[model samples]
Target: MESFNEYHIDPKEFTFLKSFQDNWQAIRDEFIHFIKQASNEDLKLVYDILGPKSKTIKTKGDAKYSAFGILFQGMFIEKYIQVHQIKYPDYGAEEASQKALVLREKYFPSLAKLIEKVNFNDDEIIRNVYFGTFHPGLDIKLHVNYNPHTNRGYLGLIVPEGDVAMKICHEQLYWHEGKFLVLDHSYPHCPHNYTNYDRTVLVVDFFKPDKPREEVIQFENEQVTQRMQENPYSLGVFGKSDRAKVEDFIKYGFTHQLEWDKAL
Candidate 1:
């Protein structure tokens, strides 16, 4: 609702950020665990090929850029939430799946509680969380597409820990571990991992509109359903069968990162 620079945002305007800043240590620890998760493990969430990216969007190559779902459009990743749906029957029972949860609980109870608090305080906000990662070179670029349908919480990116800085509008905004980079994606930006280490960010997308997030989602779905009724291919759900693709992408990035470190 407040006016801001089309390119950047001030952190002070957001009070909820303190919770995230305070819990940085725990957050980073969990993120590291997920990225290092090997197959055959149950606790970790392996990032699937973030599809429907800038180009292919539904393909792996195009997924490398942007903070994925938890998506570019606030799509909830299922593994964690499925647990909630089963644990709490009424979580989103009467609402739309896309933006129904009044509170979304994730892997870590503490983290889940934090998310709940943020939403609980606000009347209703469509908040989506995702772990976004980048490798060395220009490949791990943080390029958020200019999204007009965003507000105060346009995109809150916290670089858990890494030598990564985003280049936006000719400005190099270096990210500090635990600090927040709240900005509008309207301005094109490029974030590069200067070091060989992976630059991973805990991305939080809170879509705040005049109407509640669930209502916003319901309206959009209805509109799309109408269109789909006329044209069968107008809409399609992205599948979650890309674990191998996700691992391969991580392997490539992490392997190259290790190589870069060795070269240095």
Candidate 2:
């Protein structure tokens, strides 16, 4: 994988005129082609996994607002670990790739096929599979994902039914159902949901197949360890009694997860 610095695109280079004249049509055409290939049944499968009203989780950013996530890596529900006499599954990065494979094969085959086509690495492993949901009027600050160690992809499963929009970097894009967007998280970006309904997407991070498995695992370990140190609650690596504390932190202001973990 390339260094995070390699992915940074200067905002000045993305002028309105340049977009209109050079890039907008290409983006539009690619999205149109992707949508044409998308399956409605696959989209419904994702929604079913998420449910009509999904349980929300506290993320590293904007904890004051509600955000929901079903994580395949960096967290789990352990049935044996007891915190205050209550047992919860221990979640972490281990076996996350396998778990994601099970989910893709069983529930989201079509979506999986779409991802496989773009990610040509035959030995690639899913480093993270997250289903994130944000409600209407939610605004996320501009922040870089900053994980140059892995590749990231986002597939829009459900978007607002009415007038709503989402932005990546300086490009404001309308989320169309079943459309896919590949992104370099190391670059600065933000998301804004302006609609009456919730916005949901399948976000994936995976090791590119070209990298050796040992190197990939090492990267995953470093990333997971950093996350655990910075925000244990975000990883759900806490006792049952800590749930309220986590919720409170999310409701108010807590430490932002990645403030100290940037790749310097």
Candidate 3:
């Protein structure tokens, strides 16, 4: 708890963090290997762990940055892209970064035993888990997590060693593959990966300690990211919500692979 970082959140806050710490390496090694050797079988494994892509329980406006919020950040292509072999690609990244976005999904899990080994007895606080990959030169500008349905939870990110930069609560968080960051993403934060290689964080949603495991999973399963981002929950029809206001002040920077001689 030295003041190396601005905010001082005791690692003791989240009880499940210790279990995550205990198996971090085993989980990481298996995950990294699967991603490196991405294949058809690997893709199926990811599908098994994360369910279907159409049913990926990802929050709207995730790791990607945006000027206003998740809306203009290019996370959803279905709203705009009409033509495809039913493929809406993640565009705007430079030539070298194209593969990074697509390959992240092909590597969510390979160590099912290790993941299952992580248990909290009857607690079962982990609602959902998925891979949140950040590509080289991707800049995630400042934004806050918004969710009104049944408050109280944390956004857990298991990040690896990298030259990534994060600004949250006026402090910085250096990464270690073994470290499990249980953060309140509601605080405005920005993370920029200026490195050459792709950075992956095993993101998990840890709900209220007492929240019924069945209830948490049920709500998230029924509520897709799109529904959470529209109309009553969002869209600012009554007034300009925080998300409705354009984020003209968030710092944004991008890097291309051609600019660097090597990328890890």
Which prediction has the highest TM-score against the true structure? Answer: 1
TM-score, one value per model: 0.56, 0.48, 0.53
- Superposed model 2: Cα runs more than 4 Å off: 1-71, 74-121, 161-163, 209-213, 236-264
TM-score for predicted model 1 compared with the true structure: 0.56
Query: What lDDT tens digits, residue by residue, belong to model 2 across residues 170-225?
Result: 34555555554555555545567667677766555655444677876786666655
Number of the predicted model whose lDDT against the real structure is largest: 1
TM-score of 3: 0.53
* Clash pairs detected, candidate 2: 75-91, 76-91, 77-89, 78-88, 78-89, 78-90
Model 1 lDDT at residue 45: 22
Q: 1-264, model 1: which lDDT tens digit per residue?
A: 543365567666666767777787787665555445534332212222221222212322333443333322233434323322312233342232332232223334465666667667854353455556665543433333423334323222334355567655545565667677776553444566556555666666555343466665675455434433443221212112211244445654565577678889
Q: Write the per-residue lDDT of candidate 3 for residues 1-264, one digit (tens) a residue.
A: 344231335456666556656766665665656656768764543333222122112223434421111111112122211211122132322321233223333332333333344433524454344455666677754554533222222222434356676656545665556665555554455667667666665555455454565675565444443433432122121112223123323321122233233444
Winner on TM-score between 1 and 3 is 1
Worst 10 residues of 3 by lDDT: 65-74
- Stretches of candidate 1 exceeding 4 Å from the true structure: 1-4, 37-45, 49-76, 79-106, 140-144, 151-163, 208-264
- Write the number of the candidate with greater lDDT, choosing between 1 and 2: 1
